[model samples]
Target: MSTFQERYAASVMNTFGPPKLVLVKGEGAHVWDVDGNEYVDLLGGIAVNALGHGHPALVEAVSAQLQTLGHVSNFFTTPQQVELAEKLLELIGADAGGGKVFFTNSGTEANEAAFKLTRRTGRTHVVVAEQSFHGRTMGALALTSKEAYRAPFEPLPGDVTFVPFGDVDALAAAVTDRTAAILLEPIQGEAGVNVLPDGFLATARAIADEHGALLWLDEVQSGMGRTGEWFAHLPSGVTPDVVTVAKGLGGGFPIGACIALGPAGELLQPGNHGTTFGGNPVACAAALAVIRTIEEQDLLEHVSVLGQKLRDGLVADPRVTEVRGEGLLIGLDLAEERSAEVAAAALKSGFIINNATPQRIRLAPPLVLTDDDAKAFLAAWPAILDEAF
Candidate 1:
């Protein structure tokens, strides 16, 4: 093993298994390992590196903020922190009616804050969708439905129910007046980019309203222009009471937000929850840079156009049975259960992909990925599939 790999194994926890490569440098959508091998990064740090690696805008923003003032603690807020909060509210369309934001260091912390906020509504039960992945923390884990992740962590917080995803009847039956919130992800990223059925989000919104419960959409993996929109649930025209976002928010910096709208915004009072490094100046500055770059570069339009092209090209091969998801967050099913083999083959051929399941391949490349890079991958895809299959 390489020196770095051996050192990593000795020092780091094994929660994520072994490191795939000892990466040394990156630019745009490509990365180079210590051995000097170049490869296109299709996963984009699991959808967190929105601007890709070492983008000038992100680097400069973080550097400038750190040089000025870094962490001020939650007792006092910095201008960057307030500006980012306002920008998030503006993007979420909550500025008009006014909203509140609680910052965290990651998606899991954001969800944890929102989870606690739901308890203030005097309802303990929460209705969540099956196959949903909120986070690994105890509070967030209670909302996740995967058996394997929850089995070992028994005695989790109670009063949580899981309904089949996209099943309107099941959702309607599961929610009641006693429910505190209805949490769902418009695009189920961990479950192989499973998009919600048409009108499913609208139905969820209605159910929450009828039962007087909050509608919380966890947009951690699909927000921040990942689905060609600010948030994936925007197109549904269903305004959620609470939204949790992280992943691509900071373009690589650690930042997350739990935004509550209207009356739901007042649920978490002073001293309800707090975090030390959640909305530090540097993190907020990094997020602001990501948002500005996306707007200036018009990456949303680019993502929409290129995503369609990549999806069309990927399905051309007969081995690909189906393709799902939006923008750069794409997932495909193979004719056989060889996704792991396919991903390994892709890496060997100078590409990086994710095996979301035994038969599912997920691609969440950087939004800044160029047309030439995509074309190169398309050209090499057939051979990669052949070697794997």
Candidate 2:
């Protein structure tokens, strides 16, 4: 093994099996291994690096915040913290002073906070969908429908029902008046970017209204301009009562938020939940910088244009059976179950992609990924497939 691999195996836990690469540095949508070899980073740190590596705005914001105030405990609050919260509500179009926010350190924490908030509705049961990945935390994992992940962590706060994703009837049948909330991902990121059917979110909203349940949409992986929209559910014209956002929210700084709208905002009392490093000034500054940079650089429009080009170009190859997802969050099915081989081949040839499943390849490149880099990948696509096949 390489020196870095040996050290990593000795020090880091094996939760994710083995490290794929000993990456030492990155800039834009590219990364360099410890051996000085470079690769185009199509995964974009699993959709977290909105501005990519070594972004000046992100670096400057973090540095400035640290220089001003390094940290703040939960008992205290900072201007950056409040500003970031307001900014998130504004971005989601919920800033009419009706939205409330709970900050967390990651997407899983955000979901966990939302989970506890649901319980305060005086209801115990929650309805989720099959093949949905909320997070790995205890509370979030309880809501996840994957047997493999759930089996290992048995009895994860029960009362969560799993329904067929994209099936409005099944969801409606499962939810009752006692149901605390109905949680869903706009696109199933871990299930290889499975796209929810058209109007599925809208149907979910109607069902939640009928059942007197909170409509909680987990936008952890699909939000923060990942879909070329502020939130994936916004286009459907459904205003969710609860929304969990993370991943790209901090542009790699590790920050998340659970936003509650309407009456759902008051579900959590003062002592309902708390965190030490959730909304620290540094983290908030990082998130604010990410948001501001996205607007100023027009990264949303760029992502929209580049994503279409990529999806269209990828599907043009016969080896790719289908492509799913919007904007930066993309997945494609191979003609056969060789996604691992394809991903390995791509990596060997200086590209980093994800083998999300046996037959699915996922790509969530940085929003700031340049047109030249995308075109380069497109030109190299046919050869990558050929080598893998």
Candidate 3:
């Protein structure tokens, strides 16, 4: 019989290369492959599984909502949808007013919605940061700065200028009267969790305001308490006109939202955007449960404590050269460009992690990751590095 790997290669697109392992089931931060080998899930489905696997709250909310009202088209709205939006606004400290939400089924779509909203500013040009990642969709792709991802897809919705990330001077030079928005990721996740320099976001906000451009932060991978805060930009105290979020919003249930604040919230009129499955009751219910669970369990505070422990542990090893990030969204540089080998070694030792770049390893475990799991990984860190080297 053909193995799952063989079948996967034959039927699926080669975008992500071969599958790492045939995962069959999961509970909390642990997952079992088809061979029944258990592993700690440190990557958390690339930061999408905020609640980890089969959290009771998430499962119950999705199941109950499905049974009650599975979906409703854009022509109508559901209480779950409205309630989830309100909850997000409140969580982000946008409750003061002038905040509105547009839901999507994925991060890319959330960006697409925000992209269109920016266009309504009567300016077509957008300033994006180099080494940034927005999404794969055409519009989001246009704002993304990686040449490899954008080169082949060129002629993408044009008028975007790429500036050096975390460089306030470069950003100031880029925005002009024709610029509609200045897009940035609170932390560039796909580019190995790169954090901005001190005061960079606040500078971007100021520059955007000076040029009448919207400050659009793509928090798709850094939002939803990943940085031990509701949003990574919150600590900077800079309020972005547009914030796009996903990855952790539904705790693995697949949901995204584009929130526009103040006058920017009014840019997208009724006919400007719509989605068929964006804010369906089931997805909204899932998101609501994830948010409520985080609050009720005080996971953010737990994440802050555990993250410091894990970061300190990882950096304690000589094999790790540099550690950067906040809370559970962490990135580390290895002594050598052997991140893939390290990831493989980690998997062999019953762990799951991600190599976002040749020399960078990113850890975005579920907020529910236990102390024991983290300690285990730390205890095995030396061995894992030795094996990889």
Instruction: Indicate the residue-level lDDT of 185 in model 2.
Output: 94
Tens digit of per-residue lDDT, candidate 3, span 56-120: 99999999988888976989999998898888888778856769999999999999999999999
What digit string (tens of lDDT, one per residue) describes model 2 on residues 237-323? 889999999999999998999999988889899888999899899999999999999999998889889999999999999999999
Clashing pairs in 1: none
lDDT to native, each model: 0.95, 0.93, 0.92
What would the per-residue lDDT of candidate 1 be over residues 86-141, giving only the tens digit for each residue? 99999988857589999999999999999999999999999999999999999999
> Residue 160 in candidate 2 has what lDDT?
91
Q: Estimate each model's TM-score.
A: 0.99, 0.99, 0.98
Each candidate's number of clashing pairs is 0, 0, 0
Screening candidate 3 with a backbone cut-off below 3 angstroms (N, C-alpha, C), the clashing residue pairs are none
Residue 194 lDDT in model 3? 90
When 1 and 3 are scored with TM-score, the better candidate is 1
